[model samples]
Target: MTEGNRMFIQDKRSYSRLLLMLLLLTALVSSSTRAVVHAAVKVPDTIRVAFFINLGTKYQSLTPVATLQSANGLNLIWRDPQTGISAGTIAPGQSVRFAMDGYRALLLETTDLGAAIAVLKKVQASSNAAFVTQLTKSGKTVYQVTEGAYSTAAQASSALTKWTNAGVAAGVQTLLSARVAGPWAVEAGSYASAAEAASAAAQLGNAGLDAFAALKPQNGTLSYVVRVGQEKDATALSALQQSVAAAGFANARIPDAVEPYTSLRTDMTLNGSANKPVTLYAIPSGPSTVLRAEPAGSGGILLTERNKRTYRGSMEMSVLNQSLAVVNEVDYEQYLYSVVGAEIGSKWPLEAQKAQAVAARSYALSSGMGFQIANVVDTTTSQAYYGIGYENANATEGVNQTAGEVMTQGGKAINAVFSANSGGITADNAIEIWGGDNSFLSSAVPSPDDGPQKGLLDWYYVALPSGQTGYIRSDLLENSGQTHVSGAKYLRVTGEGTAVRSKPQVVSTVEPVARVGTGTLVVQLGKVAEYSDYSWIEDPMTPDQLLTALNKRAKSPITGPLLTLEVTKRGPSGRVTEIAANGVPVNVGAGDNLRGALNSLKSTLFSVEETGRYTIVDGNGTVREVPSQSGSLQVIGGAGTSGSLPASNAFFMDGNGNLRAVTTSPLFVFSGKGYGHGLGMSQWGAKAFAEQGYDYQYILKYYYKNVSIEKGA
Candidate 1:
């Protein structure tokens, strides 16, 4: 009885031990699985980009280094420091521990295999430390090239400085996703000739397979191989093989490691000769400290003033005219932070800011003309880019919300040109400014006044709050009545005179002048005058001054002195299409030239008038002569004056300030309307529209017809 009981107890103890072991194993397996899932979910798809920096001037040398006191350390490998080719990976720690004063990298990605391969080859040839990676996204292959990776975005910015130093085109972008290795491709066949391989590829492609001909070296011989489809794993490879067999390709196999086409050489170098500009790369000696450029060559390091300015990207100092030209090269989005505030007031509404951001982005990313070292200028010529000083919370928000968004037409970026106040109506692209049909930049219908009114003159009547009514010409108003309402308020005018009876009528005592004083709030009645740009402005120029300005701007030599100024033709916008000065036709073919010829007269819509006092001729010494007492003297050939000079045209002012008959040159006056080229989006108009509850998209659509706002590529 004792032996049987002992055997049963031993069996029970063994069973308990085995059960405990099984439970522990299950817990271990569950923990491992959870860790894998978490990692897969946590890994970011794209890198967090801080900003892009542009080196505005050519540099002689540059050096990048990690700050000694920074937690985040940089591992940089300069492929060609002079040419700005580098490769590095950052040890993540602080947000911006290492600061590269004048350098930034641009991560560019391409879906086009050929384009990607070309760029990779170019970078590899130019940069000794260049790296290229391939990633599969949404079942499509993408290739990416990074100039350098840094611990903090501030350090990574050195890439751009290097690129500019190498004189590379501003084609790099900062918005890029992390690259992952692509899958293996199934090779269908190999042939000695590319033409033969291409035929096979075509056949496979026709069978609904993604096929391409790639040249590869096999057994020391370059052979063109045809590939069908890419497979992520062995199971996918088997499935792809089966599909290829079914598509009539009996011999289809997946390579263990498909080598890239031989056309993309492993040792390919940059195509052109490297003309490395003089570059200087600065590194902060301590964390959160100002960066001082490491001196290179004979020139001592350009010491940047600490805390002088806070830049979003990096600062690039170059010698221009023997002085330092500090250029802040920041990322596209960061660049907009200051641009929006500088272009339009930061106090503008969010929608207006967003609209301005898009327009500025489009303009900056357009043709890349007028820029050598940087993408844009810090002025109206390109776009006002004042850097971090001008950046405001609202402007930054607008940039962030509309990040990577641009206005495009037919899948291409449009010009997105804009100006301050379109007066009333936007001008036609073909007729105004550039004299060509930019399909997207058509006339935008102005508020209150759609298109243009035929009968209304540019002049307007103003009723002042000081119990005075006066005739105010269109030019006197802040903006054209086109975008403004008839009863819009204007600045107060203390002293005023009589209001004209009607538009196109001369002001005289018969009209009854009403005296005005302080506290006068003038209000625009309506557009009662017709001229270019919705207003009439007079630009008075002496005969000599007119001739000099004209000759300076004329493409060809303007031989004669000022004689006759005539507007030969006018466009529908009332802008002078063709003009002649002194009978020698002024080349008004280009809008800019026309504007300059007219002393930069607000607009081309102008008429020239010559005026001088009339006098009578007499024998012996010239004496003062007045017309008959009943007859009034006439001032002929002046702006807005219409009359012929008398046959006795000799007239001069005597010593006693009396009129005498003597020859004298007449003063020329140019009367016109509006400001700017009168084309595209008007900044003031955009603000007005924004105030009226219009969104940025609506504002862009209104100005750019047949255009779509889409995320940037």
Candidate 2:
């Protein structure tokens, strides 16, 4: 059917039929049909959204040290640990005391810098000068990393020796730049008496060494010391120390070191002049169970101090991994209102929003995800369920119009899984992503899944050399006068898949377009995509960063450095089902596991390309290949730029004026289409179908095969 013709829906006849079915059900209520009513899916009046799980993660970084307060005074309860019964109400707005009960430091030993950084950020609260030290493991080039700072050189030295047999925590303390000399001299030797040092200095002077004996205070004790080489310049001092070592003074060093600087207490975060104190949970002790807080009125909304957002209904704070995991139990319809706004978004026709309501509603009911605490999470983990702030009139109308409607197959609610985009074709949930087969879920080439680039964050439409035209995500595309949609979008051409043209032409990409369909978003009938996460591009990941993503994300985390990252297998929809890290299959049971790892790329359908790889021989004659630079680097022809490379310790300033670390360069760049796993209905496609005049029922039925919209039991 033509795109223009879709405006007319395949009507299910009339609502009179629905009314008749309801009347029939009511008439049979006292009979066996009543049991069937009880058995049929019942729409919930309320749903719990696990807003924050594993609270310390960046996925929902509202607070690392999590705590929340309601302005209208909270009705608090401390549940008993044994019986899970509330002990009683507690005073509001008062500082509650909590104890540090369980805590264990996670120390990772990995191969790459990126993975190390991922763990480093987690271990040290995003502090780059993390309370971490990377040490080379014994007999292996792999890094053994940990969280902590050195208090003393002796302590630092001890840590290196005591680093678990894993070989982490190796290093001598920096000693607060002790090697720097500001009118300071090196201590050649120390003795109990000045006469002993004087005799030693005289013998050193006889050997033409610059040395003098002097009495010095050593931590409130007197000590005779032989000092050598007076120099105010740190570089000169270092040179002199090397010379001294050559002259048999092997252990000569500076003394009386102090800490480099002071930092705010661990709980509080430092932000310029203000110290953001981390709130302590009042996980009441003794008879107290778990902390629960609610606003006074049933319909009242409470604002949390932590994220500074308002939530409807009561919030229960439960402890998970020594952090607060918050669940918001809000009215079901209210939740859908926000989900529609967050998912379908505004400015997209009301029809799309209604379709979203039905899909979201059915998915929530059938997900079977909640385990007593919450039915689903607010994150993309379930669906983008922002609270009241995300609610809009258009979305509210959609939910209200399609109230209590859900898709059912075989008299049961279907798992109405959906993604932001489809990269042109939806995936069969069972086979494409999960590697299983399901009759309820099937793939379809929705006209709206143009490509990941059609409406995503950034992209480049290029005409491939093979004469096939497709869009390339921004990351893989080179700069060629690119233009992003700023004000309004225009549909230059319309077909099964919308041809969105913000402008006639702009920058394009290199790697041939993987695939294309009706990928770009459609505005009211004919306009360019306003903002859709159809395609996405992740910045180039240094080896360290890539490995960090893989390890942090993989189920059975990869232990060593990431040498290679390649998609080993793909499902029908071109969604990745297996990825090989360093040539080994990564244990990612679900595609999202791999998705969450590599910096949370939009979807499993993606591309990984190695950039600027070069082989180099180190001073130790260790030959290895590494990426060229963090950013771009100009290369010279083999015959032109011929010189010995600098030592690894040499430093250089980068384009950003920051000192580049002693590392080679970024390894891989990732780019792809689609937002979520390519499964079930594509939200972008729904919007397209709606723009084409299809009703909510038609949209849901098309995406969910053999499904009918029916009311709850």
Candidate 3:
């Protein structure tokens, strides 16, 4: 084609290649520049801190050490020395940080060197006794500062004294006056030549003490004396003392008691019947007290005073045992000694404190009274006194007067009870005696002061003027009054909402039989003097309604003489019949007897096959299921119109005791009798028996096996 055309093509290709190379170079340069511009900037300077004290409050002043991502970003590791509550996490933007003041130091990190310099400037501007300095002495550059350094030992001592004098508490560290050793300027190994003194000073400094040499004349030689200053000798002494105290030496100074505990004191009176004396030991500090029983060691025994006695059967003493469990009681021979000899601390010596402890122990034992104790110093005299339950156990520890007054612990109000008729005092009588219609203000029977009654109630029991042993409501009986019923016994019944009745029927039942529902959670209300038939039942209403009602009371009604029950529910039974849809006749086989077949048909079909009839009600109220027949009707076999019976069909007994065909398409009949399982009390039957004059107790016995009717608690 021609040399000229080839040359043109070659030239075009060369120019295109040159253009591509230039473009590639340009793109590479642009990319490299972009990367250099986008690379992360160098991180700046950072600061960190450590804590030196615990400031329980004032959280914001603490400076937590932080890691800096940039000037605007920070990662905080905040630690509160006071509360020991610490947290660490990344933080962005300037925000309020929390830490304990005077208890923590701030650790800071920054990317800008300028920012670090700025922070130092701020520290310098504030008079908060803080500053930053780069420690060149340490090979590694460390920022540190001198805080409140004393120039001399005398200066530090005076400073501490001034703080105490001004009531500017530095706490035990300053209060107890602890001292720390620091650099001192003193002469060591005096010599005529300054070089020798300088060498000695250098040597002492190398020994890790801040020492200096002071040249002075020593006999015939010029000697140098090396002295160390700023040593906190006081701090070491204070710390040692604290350590000793914490190691259980707080009471080591007091002499150990050599006397023995006393047990079984004589001449004690029951309920103060005869004036008696009981000796109790005073703690080492005058009026303080501790209880110990004879032959018993420490720790095992309860805090009971030695030889603290009332009487053999004193009510207060017994109650004390219940509420204030004297651990080392003379319950056994070894118990007395085991509890007495243990190490009892001096804290038990304060009489007021001990009394409070006793009262508290009593409450714990009896679950009755509530009490507290506290120490008080008479403002007028600066003397210590104890205040207990409004009075002082220590103030009058030795003032046990026989005739001062029959003082009740808290002034006995009316915590006792009296017993009376079946239902206790009627609502009318309760209102009259208690000055209010308070139902809870019921009475209890009387027993000796030392009787089994652990707590006081409003009720009591007494013999009637007529020699009746029945319950007479307590509120009606005064302190010394006597009244009784003809008879009394505890009677109760068990069942979930068990029904109590006057006549044992669903109707004519005005009151309950006594609800023994959920047989547990019982409280003794009172004894039964003579409850009428179904008189004082726990629930005097419908079974479900009564349960709902009883739960609303302040306390549940529970009495003694509880009866355990076993319940059973009756099942369905009776007889029913089925019938054919059409009155068509079917042929019977020779083996199928007519009577047997008819009996089976009686349950299988409603039609009376023997009479060819069915019992049906007509529009006019006339009964008619069978069509009028000419003569004595009977089931007869037929052909054509009648359907033939299936083969292999058999008759069996149904639940109703009726014979019928056992097939997929079968009929059911219901003619059940008896309300429930014929196991225990039958309401229907009870009514029948009651109609015959049988009493409630008689009815109970007749139905329940091996049970007796007693008064409830």
Candidate 4:
């Protein structure tokens, strides 16, 4: 038997819920706790991962919480997970659909436009990120507004002043698809009154801590304990202890024993027909319900049959704002095996896998209850944890060899963030990648892959009007060989508002002697702008397109017309440190937010430019020539992003030495290296490094500064 195979287990959406009030599905299971159970500092042996939380754009689609079954040909049982009492059994290949029993959402909708506007305003007043949707009702179009996916009609009515539907909805937000921190918590004293306990929890929460009032029942009286944060290893517990002390709750308490958690009452629909309020498990008992529910299911069982995904451990069903979360509570090492395989592939070099295993472990332990219910989620948002299917002998070897080992810095677990590729140059932890913060991640240095991976350049060396040479993109120069103009005057301005400088470069924005629009004749010039690709690049984002994206994803969206996008600052490796839109510094959240806002850049090490306007398409689906005047020019073709055009127009010069002017429309070209934030260990770089004979220790040390691979919880 494995040494420590214990059975246990963001969306960025504003669809967040109150952490403490989660998992209560009806009056069936608010069972009383005996004591506050002041826990001590200890590392967790099992990890609870919340999986298959399919919440997306509201009401587009909803993924049903599917079945859980055993695949190892072992018999499974449905049980009251809290008491570890078996309620029923699940046969091999059979399924138990965790149907919403007490879980229900009250839907609110109104067809009238005026009513919907008022309803949306009232609902959003309370600070829930609610929105209105135009959907269909009984073949007639209706404008539906909502508050929370309220579990009861009374809650829905209370959210708005008028026109509340007393109707119940089948499920919560219809998501089309499924999509951490230091593990430390501050627990205050228990109170006899739930209200007082909630007040204390809110006090801590208002202090910016993730505070939740836990129901710790005693004798038959309802007592509550104010809990904050999740489990943390001993090394990191000291900081949390001090933080709680500063937050006014000094006595340090962590979950070192049976962790109390809220339970939901879900109907175990076995074989799609019969339903019962039974806790699903294969074993009669092992551990407590909320923390670790040891399921005796066999390996390879179809936990989510619809997705053909299999998982070990037990599945716990709960709802956040009525959105269903199927949490997989599994052993920590077992989870790592799947994560290593899913992240770097099962066939990756063993040393690389080992490095990944240790990194994943450290990352997991360093995270708090990310989903508010689980320590992590089975996604890249936390880390790639695909479940049992991705587990393999190679990955298992990697995990087993590095069992309980994590990367620690200064005797504490570091964040140990890793990416697939670091392009060529790694992002500087203190500046480039996310923003100046991570001196711990300073190990992210330049990485070398097997072959050409990062940015590559190919520029045209051309002679200028004054007989000077510079590097520029070849598109800006085409030798006609047939002198379209006359002697010594053989050039046409391809782009409107093409700034003519004394010297040629990739692009120059400084004061030039003159500026020209499309077809404005000019002699050839020099250049120094860079254009490179990864052989596989995403669709280019234009200035307008990027402007829309900036508005959509930036923390402080450019409310006014978006025009110019320029990289104002960069890190050591030339990754964007700061950016400007229309000369104003953008407030895009650090890390991948800039990349995400700019239409999902491969990485943050990118360059953006006003590459002149591309093919112009107006609102009528017609491509327009360079207009003589410009009030506003919206372009299409490339991602269809919109932005403000240049203020003035460039003039075209005829062969007879006459001049004609036109509009200035420009595109923003983004080019970069790598495929992620470029921080920490590069997985692909690790593979290459491993293949080049670097051991796992060397590989890890290369990416994490002053880190020592050591064994821990």
Against the true structure, whose lDDT is highest? 4
TM-score of each prediction: 0.43, 0.51, 0.13, 0.54
lDDT of 2 by residue, 253-309 (tens): 764322111011112212211322332332311121245566644433443433456
Q: Write the per-residue lDDT of candidate 1 for residues 1-713, one digit (tens) a residue.
A: 69989999999889888889888988998555322111111111111111122333532222222211112332322211223312223332211122232212544555654554455566667653343334333345444454542333444445555654664433544235322112345777777676787677667655655565654545544466776653223466788788788878788877754243321111111221231111112221112212222211221111223222344544343322212234444467877787787777777788888888888777666635344445555556566665567789988888888877777676667778887556566766676567677888867456322223345545655544543333555543454223223324464443344243322334454553444444345555434454434455353466688778887777776776565566777666666777776556777457646877766776564676454323454445654433212243445453768554344234344456443322234556565545566677777667777888988888887888887666664
Across 456-542, the per-residue lDDT of candidate 4 in tens digits comes to 443333334433322334454445443434243345546766554332333344465455456544443223334322222333355
Instruction: Let me know the TM-score candidate 3 reaches against the reference structure.
Output: 0.13
After the best TM-score superposition of candidate 4, give how far the Cα of residue 429 lies from its true spot, in angstroms.
Answer: 2.7
Cα-based RMSD of candidate 4: 22.7
Cα lDDT, model 4, residue 72: 37
Could you list the CA RMSD of all candidates, in the order they appear?
A: 28.1, 21.8, 43.4, 22.7
lDDT to native, each model? 0.51, 0.54, 0.25, 0.55
TM-score: which candidate is best? 4
lDDT (0-100) at residue 169 of candidate 1? 30
Candidate 2 vs 4: which has more TM-score: 4
Per-residue lDDT of model 3, residues 487-526, tens digit only: 2222222345544332212333354433334332222223
Candidate with the larger lDDT of 1 and 3? 1
